[model samples]
Target: MGETIRREWRVEGMDCAACVASVTRAVERLPGVSQVEVNLMAERLTVSLAPGASVAAVEQEVAALGYQAAPLPAPDAAGSAAVPGAAGPDRSEAGGHGHAHGGHADDPAEAGKPWWRTGKAMLVWALGGLVGGAYLLSFILPQGQHWLFLAATLLALIPFGRRAIALARAGSPFSIETLMCTAALGAVVIGAAEEAAIVVLLFAVGELLENVAAGRARAGIRALAGLMPRTALRRRADGTTETVPADRLAVGDLVRIRPGDRVPCDGSIEEGRSALDESPVTGESVPVARGPGEAVLAGAINTEGVLHVRVTRAAADNTVARIIRLVEEATASRAPTHRFVEHFSAWWTPGAMLVSALVILLGPLLLGWDWQTGLYRGLAVLLIACPCALVISVPAAMASGLSAGARRGLLVKGGAALEAIGAARTIAFDKTGTLTEGRPRVTRIIAAEGAAETEVLALAAAAEAGSAHPLARAVAAAAAARGIAIPPASGAGAEAGRAVLATVAGRRVAVGSPRYGAEAARGGLGKLAAAMETLQGEGNTVSVVLADGAAIGLLAFRDEPRPDAAAGIAALAALGVRAVMLTGDNARTGAAVGGALGLEVKAGLLPDDKLREIAALRGAGPVVMVGDGINDAPALAAASVGVAMGGGTDVALEAADAAVLKDRVTGVAELMALSRATLANVRQNVAVAVGLKVAFLATTLAGLTGLWPAILADTGASVLVTLNALRLLGWTPRL
Candidate 1:
């Protein structure tokens, strides 16, 4: 009745609302589907079924949607992802909910009363502590009270220590807990109950602290998990508006963007113009100007305009949706640092027990020794040989480190993958989406011949009033921002190119890019190109606007540069990594954005060209490429290390090796730093564990240690290493 199944999938070429709806409808028609949710933003659809819902059925539905489904991703299996709020829909449901075959998060084995925690686990621990304290007081109170401590210890051991006994019997006998439990039990059998209690209680404390660290690191990730806005004003056939969930909005539906409202979806302005604050999308401080025919995003605030918008894409396919999807997918793929304890369990734990048994049996027989003496030596070996320190060290560090990165808005999927590439000495960047802001902005305006400066501007603005071209939009936006009113343009004539000839404010206006308007002015090409270079040199994208056979204005647009680009690059340099930018934009735009942000810029390269550049960089050392969305997907896959932005497409997110959960690429630096820190701690912890084990083993074999001290040393070192690893919880940089 509780049988469960799951699979992963890839959604291709799903760009907007209609595509998402088409796919969602197709997916919902499958057999045995109890419920289906198409998280279009994630480019992944989830289906929960009652019975008889086959993986094949789901695959067929995906095929019908022009996509393919496959198994879920896996890199580091042991490190648990600190998912927030239902794990953002990917993890399915916890608490006995069965996940797919590859890996499922099951309930903790044994009584999971890890120490350093509160609640049920903590209560169990406190009771055990009370029992031990009571037993100790019995010596001072009544002799019969000793049983109280013994009974409490045995009960606690039954629940939590069952796993320890199983672990001891298992192939890997040198495990951290196996060692602690053996030593604790040895002391108890010898009637030294308090030492054993202390060992188990302290071990639980360390485990509890590690869990808390991990929980804290992932504390606020759920804050934005279900932030999808519900209702929106949709414009319809009679010019009437009705409210609907932004999710229900479809393409070509008119959306009303009232003042002080977020744009419901990506769309073109059908009516009105106003200032919009797009800080959430671009991390920019300035309010941008948007007018009729301009593009507005789903998460942007319309500051002053009453925008009547024709939805270009559905709510689930909007920019905000894509951004959310990108973040989720990127986060899902993270890998944590090496888990030494689990890995060593295959050999180290069992090997320790074998040697302990040999020393007890053979050593006493070979030399003149009594059975009690040999038994005690064997017991001491088992007690002090506990690999708890080594076992707990790596996981504790990894959990805390990963959590810390998340708290700072840098989601490193787990510890392993981070450690794999974060220390690379070379970093590459994709210019359009990674180094520069991905959008073009209007920066300057120029005047052409046969027109006064203001008159030419007004005419250009008017002619471009209804354009969607980047250059035209820039000019119009600039004019609108300055409060210049442009009358309706005359009937457009000759649609041979991107421009139209028209009359505005009773003046003839031919508005378009430089190539659109005929060459009527002298040295026009030279003038335009030169102006473009100058602006480009300063790290701005320049487009020439022409009107009436003359170059009327030089319009510039730059993708918002990352504010922390300079600082992040410097940090990477300090870590001995060189940075370079590769972009598909023209040389000027590329150089401008890069130079402004103090990056090494490589511009005017196609997709293949970017790939070649990456291959070339790898010749020097491993390369980490940071980018966002589709254009960078291929290059990201090809790079030695692919770091995608959380604000990019699922394509890029799926391809990249790592992702920064925040919209900016700066998180990449922070993630790498945390990974390095975690790796360092893992190494340090392992060394401490091994060193202590060797010394204790040698001392015990030489009969220089008693059962009491041996048990304490064995369990105490593990507790120490485990606690030390938890220190990474707060080890983040000042990002």
Candidate 2:
């Protein structure tokens, strides 16, 4: 065994799933090639090669399959080096004929050309003219009509026949081109020249329609890359600004943003305030108000005021760039349904050819049919069984679904995750950042005898100022909000998970859990015990302040649920999915939060305990775990689907199968709705593709239809299937 290296190439003219299979098969046959993956939506091919294999051989093999291949630079060469439209040769350019061995050309250049200027359209027009000329000559000289029709059919078969031969030699013998050439040649041999001419013309027109639909789908995903501005206004140390390419921006560079201009990079506001419309990156419809010190994402539009922002992320690491990369990567992984369709089509194509052979040979011997009749019926069967429609049903829908989700800030990793999320039966939510705001706030305060509320808050804030715990921050924030001055504390230290002790104004002060406060207070809690009980019962975490071994005051902090938490839970219930909350918080606090949102609560759980609950929840059906902290990473990976909130830690995002970038609890329900809708669309497309094939095959074999109808059955079904799948690109949640 030798070391293996992986390489990626941008492929041209891969419009359908069958094209992907052809490219895969051709490259896989090369010696020393270990693995191959083709993503049709992104038009990318990835191959792993052993040490002895050469990149030239891989490119040659793909070229043999009638697709153009170009090597991509390493991912980290430059910030936007891997981005599609960033500072490189135009990928849309297709050299030479701009045609593939398949029946249609999906080269980006060809797809964008005017309909009358396209090669497919030109072919259709030329063939239609020939057919029309033949018919006109028939009225003037009936005896020469057959010869003229034969001439037109032969001319049409020249391109089709050449492509069929190339595809056969490249290991795809049952391609649509092969079927078309075979049917048309058989028609000419049987003296149906006029019908053959019409059939050829109709097939060309069908290919044109398929190409148009495919171009539309590709355009939808490619639009995301265009959100980034090409140029950025960079500010220098002397307070002067210069316009430069966006990709040249480095971290910490300040840039001025004008009203109605798209932000050039991900940055934080440094000088002014403005309302930014972030719909392009986050799908947020309304413009959000942002002031100095707030972060802004690249691709957001500055809708109101002038501002200067300091760049926080490089061009390629911005939100828009990441979204584009993630979408392309997602399209590379095949879902279970997509894999099944591909496998089924692989067998169906060859099997259909075998059945066609039997129909032609056996009909003459067993059914006493004439030679011409048997041959004609066999050709019809071949046309009816092209397999173009059935093979494309799954991928077309999956691509559209992924693109639609990306547009709405819902990023699924791939088709597999998208499919799994749709079938989620029970959803488990982590409490802190996933359900509540995750930031504790001071809700109430109780002062003991001889202690003013301000005095108590000031002393506690001084002791907690040195700690970074949530409760400590809450106490400090409360004191600051009240404009109370906190004197400097000396010898400040935090006890592990318990308390913080400090010397405040020459007197020792302790602030932390109620138990720690009681221990420090030599004169017990006394009158403050009842107040502590009331606060705890109300689901608040109480931190007591003590000075000179005497209790001073009690601070009650509570993390509240988000505004949409209850509505989001109700939405899941409406969809028949049960929502549960799993938290490490105490049972009383968890219940208080969960109860308000009508969710079942499993409180006081460790990391391992959450995994157990996830495993138990799986018994009923698929489980989707939503979390935003490192503690939830285990359960997120353990569930059927893991969704990370965009505001979550990096570890949680890495562990999750999908991410909700808008950081809204309502996004969870929206993601579920989108997934279910996409699955339904796939089912509809498959049913349409398969149902038409069965119906047409039966009719063709019974002698009720001929070559024209057989060609329509194949080409028409493909167009219908593609159009149906494209509907998912515009899908939205009913809620």
TM-score of each: 0.58, 0.87
Error of 1 at 580 (Å): 0.9
State the lDDT of candidate 1 residue by residue for 367-456, as single tens digits. 777766776677777766655456556654565565455445454444446666666777888765566555555666655444355665
Worst ten-residue run, lDDT, model 1? 96-105
For model 1, the local distance difference test gives 0.58
Q: Write the per-residue lDDT of candidate 2 for residues 1-735, one digit (tens) a residue.
A: 768999988776676777787888778888988679888877788889898888999888777666778787774644545345232333232221233544334444654456556666677788889999999999999999999999999998887787677677778888888888888888899998888888888888777677667766776687787788878899999999999888778888999999999999888899999999887776667788999999898888999999999998887777777787778788777889988988888788788889999999998899999989999999888888788888888878888898898888788889999999999989999987778776899999899999999998999888888665567778889989999999999999876435788999998998866767777788789999889888878998777888888898888889889888999999999999999999766577778888899999997676788889999999989999998845577888999999988632344335689988777788899999999998998899899999988888999888898889888887788889889989998888787
lDDT of each: 0.58, 0.81
Clash count, predicted structure 1: 35
lDDT of 1 at 170: 30
Q: Enumerate clash totals for all models, in the order shown.
A: 35, 0
Point out the worst 10-residue segment of candidate 2 by lDDT: 90-99
